[model samples]
Target: MSDTTGGLLTIAALIILLAAVHKPFGDYMAHVFTSAKHWRVEKRIYRVLGVNADSEQSARSYTVSVLGFSLISIVVLFLILVGQKALPFDRGLPGMPWDMSLNTAVSFVTNTNWQSYSGESTLGFAAQAGGLVIQNFLSAAVGIAVAIALVRGFVRSRSGELGNFWVDLVRGTIRILLPLSFVAAILLVSQGVIQNFGDHTVHALTGGTQVIPGGPVASQESIKELGTNGGGFFNGNSSHPFENGTPFSNLIELFLLLVIPVSLTRTLGTMVGSRKQGYAILGAMTFMFGAALAVVTWAEAGMHSQAAQLAGGSMEGKETQFGSWASSLFATATTGTSTGAINSAHDSLSPTGGGTVLVNMMLGEVAPGGVGAGIYGILVMAVVTVFIAGLMVGRTPEILGKKIGTKEMTYVALYTLSVPAIILVGIGLAIALHGTPGYMNNPGSHGFSEVVYAFTSAANNNGSAFAGITVTSHFFQISLAAAMLLGRFIPIALVLGLAGSLAKQGKVPVTAGTLPTHTPLFASLLVGVILLVTGLTFFPALALGPLAEALS
Candidate 1:
């Protein structure tokens, strides 16, 4: 098939498969967190963890549990990493350095999965499969729990209790994430992703001997994308042959990363008792996803870079087995879903393609966001959209039959402002750090883009680095760790708070004055609001970085 045709088919197939499972998966998730019935295994696990599964919690209580659990998880993982060399099972690898361990622990637990250090050489099997993989499941489960809590806010009234955090967390992992990941893992293994705990296999080449790495990659790979945690087992990430051996592997990885985030829209629609409203959000997400893919494809095809000019295409940093079409698709999908698993080097993307990735993260990643993150992120933006429209029409802001008041708006305001605040501050600080030796590999406007992109990825909880910027220092470690943690849980806290306030109000009767959030017009409005807000927020940075590089 032709390049463009192949690209269209790859992307189209993903959307189609997602459509097939959206209702079933979404409904299953809805049933999971809300069901009164508990599995016998769930009961046992809860007892073991000292969790009272039946006890409901206020939003504050729920938030506390999330924070407490995450904090503890971070500490546990850090201990595992820092003490790896002495551990019984992880016998060979050296313990992680202090700051890297802390940063990595925070990264995985927050669902950011940002890796400053390569996984192949640095971490042992115990830390990789046991510690990091555990967080992959837990962190994703935590995200969905928060999203469902927000849904509860819209659906329930006159209730302070959202749900039990432990119950929600357990149900999400056991009921939804684990099952899906299990099946995806098997599929990946069959398609040549490794599933072992052995040492690297050695082979002799014409020039010299080569040592190929092996691990429990298929199982971790499945959840890495499926959970929207993008930490790679190898330094080359998905671009590495062993991590993703073939075009088919690339295709399936793309599907896995996007499936949950895309379907969560349907889950939202189902839980809120309005599938149309879910469709409205999906419509907005699809628009942005499609637009990014198209522009990226065009940019890659244009081969705008000096390197691309020599290579005769956008093949400089892309995996040739997947080709430019697949590379562009992967770029858009990874950025679009908060899945930072790169099949190619994002830093090598032509100026336009790389900037689009930045723009995707900057847009709050709401277009089919990372697992639960995308749904709530977009929904919060929806609140902003309706509020703006309400002002223009001089009507009370109401969504899903509830009045959006000052209290709800305040939560939305905080949620909206948190990301840009973190990103801009981190960028300024990173630029200052630029004067240090080895801080940047590329100097000039493109170098500035690398700094901006690093903070953008961290603050947005996107783990994909733009490369060419050294982030191994104490400054980047602490600062980026802070950005990932705050960027993740702070918005989650605000969403839960909004959910709490929204839960307390009784649903209003629909009227002529009520804004039609389910309609196409509202979907368009949501998209417009997101674009306008992100454009205004990040435009200056863009002009100075990618845009400047492109113009030059």
Candidate 2:
């Protein structure tokens, strides 16, 4: 099949699958969060953790619980990574260096799987499975829990309570993530993703020995994509044949990363007692995603350069099994969703194509962002939209009957500004440091793009790299770790704060002056606000890097 035809067909199939599953899966999630009866196992686990699931928490308490749990997770995972050489499944690999250990630990704990080391060479099965994989589940669960709490902010009236963080976290893992990951793992293994415990050596066609590494890849791959964690069991990530063996598996991984984020919109609508609101949010997300996919695909397929034309397409750094179109799709999906698993080397994308994905991350990945992150991210945008609309219309801003007052907007402003601040500042610092030039593999606009991409990915909790820069130095390591940590928890803390503020307000009855947020107009406004905010903040950086390269 022609690449264009194949790409179109694959996209069609993906949309159909997403549509087929959206309502049922989204509604099921709503039920999962709202259900009164807890599973026996959940109760036991809660007891062991000293959590009173039945008791609700105010926003402050919930935030503390989340921060405390994640801090503990980081420390524990750090020790596991740094001490992995002593473990039985070491695979003859030494423990990670102190700085890299801290970076990896913070990366996984924050749900940003930004790796500075190759997975196969740097980690053993014990670290990959016992440490990283466990965080994949919990960190994702934490994001979903926060999103649910934010939803509660909209649903409840005149109350400070947003559900218990412990309850949401446990239920999200046990009831939602676990079963889905189990099924996905089996499907991936059936599709030829490796599921073994050791490496094997083979004779190469060049009469050389090759060591093929193997691990419990299927198990890790499932949760990695499903949770939107995106750390690869092998450094090649989804591009590695053992992790994503075929065209079908590639599509599956893409679907796994995107499904939860897309479906959570429906959950938002259901929980708010207005499916139209969810549809509005979903509409905006879909529009952004589709537009982005088109731009990257067009850019890659155009074959603008002399070399690309000679090669018949922009084939450099893309997997042969998955041509430019599919690679473009993967790039768009990975960046747009914040999953960051690259099936193709993002650094080798055409300048335009590269710029689009960078813009995707700059848009905060809310074009259906990461698992729990997307829903809340867009909701914050929606609030900003209404606030703008209110100013325009000379009326009070409200959504789902809750007023977007000064306190709420304070949280929204900080939530919106924090990540961009981290991204830009991080890039500026990296560029100014004298030793940074040594890290550049490409020395001009492309090099600038690489630094921008790294910090953008890290600060947004997206975790994909542009692949040409070396970030192993202490400065890059610590700075990127700080970016990941702040990029994650700052917005989360603010979102929870917004939730608490919203929860305290009594629902304002709908009236003639009230703005209808569930309409197409509102979705368009939300999209505009997202674009305006991102463009204003990141356009200068883009112009300096990708835009300059593309134009030149």
Candidate 3:
């Protein structure tokens, strides 16, 4: 098959596999969250934590629980990394620097996984498995818990409670993420992704010797992609052959990135009592994802850079061990979701190609966004779309039988506008501190794009970078940490509140003037709504960066 055909086929087959498992997986998720009975093991953990599994909490309480758990996690994890020299399996790596350790702690716990330090050299196997790996499961569980809480808001009426946060978190991890990750890890190991913790091995050669580092990689690799927490065990990320050993390993990682995020649409649909509602959201996400893939794939195929012009593509920084087709595919999948495990350096991508990645993240990563994040983020957009369309058609905006009122719209407005505010302001701060902390390797429009992409990645919690900027200074470590926290928890808190408001609301009967949100027309409008917000917010900065370079 042609390379283009192969790339397209890979995406198609991946989507098909997702669809094949969607109903079963999604339904299982719903059951896990909503079932009355808990497993004996889960019951034991709940008792130990002093959790009341039977009593659901209000949105405020749930939010607090999430925050409290995360804060404790951050402190605990920070200590683990900072004192790793004194811990077991130190592997001769000492304690990390305080600021970098804090940043790493906050990043992983928040599900951003934006590494300011290389994992292989900085973190030992014990820290990776105990601290980072465990957070991989918990952070993702937190996301699913929030999404399930929001779903409960729509599915339950006259009920002020969302759900028991402890229950949801436990069930999501044990029942959902753990099993899937076990299987994915095995597959990765079978394909030669490293699974052991043996130390560095030196192979003697005729002239010299080569040192190879090894750790418990495949276990961490599975959840890193599956949970949409894209921190790599190695600095090369998926590009490292040891992490992604073959073309099939590349495909496996790509599929893992997309599987949960996409199936989440079905999970949303199943929970809300209308499968069509979920399909509408899924349709909008798919359309946007496909559009992004097309642009990036096309742009990569074009010869925009001097080297690319000669080589017929920008092969630099790409995983040539596979092919450009696979790298392009990985780029599309990585950016489309908040998963930032790259098989290629996005900095070397053509202007349009890299800009597409920026645009995808700037749109709040809702093109089948991060694990539990995708469904809730797009649902908020749907609410905004319904409200606008309702205003235009001169009627009430109702979705899944709930009225979109001032309270609902208020939460939606806060959730939608907050990220851009964080992005624009964070960019301003970084640029003000430029020439030092925000140093860029490239100059002109391309350099500007690097700064823009970093804050965009942080504020949207995507965690991928253009890789041309120097961001290891105090300013970036602190500012980007702040961005990742707000970008993640703030919207989640608001979403739960909106869910709370919607849950307390009475289901209004469908009137003749109600906008049909499940139809293709509404799906189109939903896409428009998403673009409208992202475009209006980021267009000026984007134009100044990537667009300027492309035009010049």
Compared with the true structure, all predictions reach lDDT values of 0.89, 0.93, 0.87
Rate residue 241 of model 3 by lDDT: 79
Candidate 3 structure quality by residue, lDDT tens digits, 265-284: 88888877778988988899
Q: By summed lDDT, which 10 consecutive residues of candidate 1 come out lowest?
A: 429-438
| Distance from true location, Cα of 461 in model 3, Å | 1.0
lDDT of 1 at 39: 100
Assess candidate 1 and give its TM-score to the true structure: 0.98
Task: Give candidate 1's root-mean-square deviation (CA, Å).
Answer: 1.2
lDDT per residue for candidate 2 within 288-354, as digits (tens), equals: 9999999999999888654587888898888889988889999999999878899999988999999
Where does candidate 2 have its weakest 10-residue lDDT segment? 304-313
| lDDT-based ranking | 2, 1, 3
TM-score of each: 0.98, 0.99, 0.98
By lDDT, the best candidate is: 2
The residue-by-residue lDDT of candidate 1 on 398-497, one tens digit each, is 9998899999999999999999999999988777753643687777888888888899999888899987688899999999999999999899999999
Quote the lDDT for 9 in model 3: 84
> What's the best-to-worst order under TM-score?
2, 1, 3
* Number of backbone collisions per candidate: 1, 0, 0
